[model samples]
Target: MMKKPNTAQTILSVASCKMTRAILRKTGRGGTAIPGIVAMKAAKNILAAVSEGMEIVVVTGTNGKTTSCNMIEHALTSGGHECLLNKSGANMLHGMAADLIAAADWLGKPQYPYAVLECDEAALKLVVPYIRPKVIVVTNLFSDQVDRYGGVQNVLQEIRTGVERSPESVLVLNADEPLSASLARSTPNKVVWYGLEASVGTQGNVDLADAGACPECGGEYAYDYHTYAHLGGFRCPRCGYRRKDPDVAVISVDKKGTDGSTIHLQCDGVIQKVRISLPAVYNIYNAAAAIAATKALGLPAQEAIDSLSSVQSSFGRLETFSLNGNRVQMILVKNPAGCNQAFSYVTGTGEDYSAVLCLNNRTGDGHDISWIESADYEKLCADPHLKKIYAAGDCREELYARLRKAGASEERMERVSDYHALVEQLKEEGHPVFLLPNYTSMMELRQAMTQATGNREFWE
Candidate 1:
């Protein structure tokens, strides 16, 4: 157990956070992580001190962490339960500490009993030891920011080290992903599994990641069916390792399209039809994870299932905006699997649309943009629904090179550095639009889109 701080220490810590946050707001820059750093410097273990008696649920993984966390938070709040979260999508230790600190009174007393934190996969070990959460959710894992973590194996190790620290915490693991599902053996922690039992009918890209190698034994395996990249029923040829029965599973994806999906789900033994407002089958994985996590937190499975229908898009993840009389949907693409899924959503229907693809190597966007080579833009190029494919950001040459290889003609693609010019063209064209940008590019472009479409809005 952590030693509680004295009254004097609490005052100093809270004061430090307040002063630092005020200065950041005044400067209009760097408000998320700095304040918590300063506060922790003043009083060590400030996250533990502020969250002394709170119930925390930490969601960590490469792709679905934010979406899964948002779904859990929505269910909690929609059911008349007040809770706090790191609204800025900051999953680092310092950002979460700042959020918890802000939620506390001057004496470092928590105002809410429930807190949901989105933690970075590598940082999960660091944050979980302090928060000692009631439940930890690991959405599917994949190679993310290879420049930072090196590979998926390294990230998997980081999460295991953290879970090892909290052996008593119940973990909600993705049953189909060997990288994530392998966590079940890392510790004595109780595990609740959730995943898609089969494909949602569109996971047919032959380029799916080679999840055939068993994480335990380095032997090749075979898949019964593929839902998406590296996810499905699997059994190792050498070792007996295989996918287990998921507690909360997507038994069948009843319907899916550009707008959204309707899936038949079996939640902790009860069968229910879940209509998720988000598009793509990846979100089906997210909804299942949310339901499992919420149930572990003592929420009724039905309430969590009911809340899935209303979970709105978080920040730049599949957010829709309106510009002059046109509707535009923005999807954040980080890796090959996620990028390919976005392509499927944009061209899933027969409706023609214009799109802008941005690539950047800014620190926030990962210094490596070579991942684009792994992403298939051929679908977008061949689709009859494509009007114009605009390439933006630092790596247009490389992006264009890949597009050319994918058969995109020079006449079919245009270059745009000025986001305002891109918006003006969209307004004139009056066709539906799709915005695909990485981390930094998304921030830069979403700023312009939000500024132009301030009043007119459409809910997806």
Candidate 2:
């Protein structure tokens, strides 16, 4: 049970936060985190107070956090449960505080029965201590925001800290990810592992693996097969750490196309054919994660699988739009692995599409442009269906240089610095447009495209 605050300070804090949010919204500012910051500063225990009596699920990882959270939220809502979420992609402590405060009344009482939070990996340590979620879903870990996280080990430690704090929370982990699977050994929390079974096919050869060395013994791990980016059937020769059988496994893939996929999902010995509306192997992993999470919440596996069939791409991830009679698909790429996935998706579509690569070196997007080299840009350039490539964003020059180095033809390359101009140019292109943007650049591109198309703003 949540401890209600009877103090006048608590009341004043909640009132001030609410008022600030309202004022910001009215003034055409999307102040997503300010209210929570103000509330937390005014009353330190505000999140705890409001989060009481709600079943909270915290989703955190290097990638797929947003999509996974969206899937879980969709499942919960479709199952007739009112849920709260930080929909503005605010996953930090201040942002989370703001979200919870916004969902509560003036007295910091929650109106919803559930809160599905997309949490930043570092922010997990801060949030889990206070909210103590009923379930913590770790999608997977990879090198991301290198300037902020320093290294993948640091990220693992941060998530481990959060897990340790929430001893009672059920953990939905990825068995194929050695780092994620290792978390089960550290914390006393009950863990439910989910991953692709061997029948789904092996990951293609890549020059690098994020988790090449075993976390347990610091020895090079061997793999029976790989899905992508160091996720698959792995075994540490030195420490005997091996992949565990998943509670929710993808037993077979019936069909995989540009639109979606059909797979056989086996949960607790029961198998069912599930359709994932989103394309890509990464999304299949996301579907497995969502199914495991829903099961952890005591929801039927079929309910979650059904919700996945209708799950639309969240925010800028594989979001499609019809602009001026031309199709535009926006995919958010923050790291090499994610970028490679997008590249594969675009080229595999078998359509002649114009591609826009937006790069930004803002702090939010790690300043390390070097990771772009790891993406299979050469393969993307080799695709004959990729008609033309447009470079945009603050780091357009860098992107152009990278494209050239990747063997992209100079005749087909152009630079569009202004997002509005880029959108206009894309509108004129007769073929479909695939836009890939980094973190900050994604927000800018989405805003420009949405404003021109009259689509609802992200905050809405």
- Report lDDT per candidate: 0.82, 0.85
lDDT of 1 by residue, 1-460 (tens): 4566778888899889988987876776543788888988888877778888888889998888878888888888988889887777767888888888988999999999899899988888887767789999999788778998888888888999989988878999999887888889758998889988886666538553635367687877677877788888888867888899999989998888666789999876678788998887788888898889988887887878898788888877888787777778889998888898888888886698988899888887779878888877887888887988899888877787788898877887998889887887888876889999998888778878877888322111
What is the TM-score of each predicted model, taking all chains together? 0.95, 0.96
- Best lDDT among the predictions, by candidate number: 2
Q: Which stretches of candidate 1 lie over 4 Å from their true place?
A: 207-212, 455-460
lDDT, residue 23, model 1 = 85
Question: Candidate 2 on 1-460: residue-level lDDT in tens?
Answer: 2345556767887898888889999998773788888887788878888788899999999889988988888888888889997898888998888888888887888899999999999889888777979999999888877778898889999999989989999999999888878899888999888998873443334534678577677888888877777887889888897899999999878887767899998987889889999887888988889889988987787788889889888888888888997888889998888887788778777889999999999978988888887777887898899999999889899889999999998999999879998887778899999989998999899999998787677778
lDDT of 2 at 268: 74
Alpha-carbon shift of residue 266 in model 1 (angstroms): 0.9
* Model 2 misplacement above 4 A: 1-4, 199-204
Location of the lowest summed lDDT over 10 successive residues in candidate 2: 199-208
How much does each candidate deviate from the true structure in C-alpha RMSD? 2.3, 1.7
Top-scoring candidate (TM-score): 2
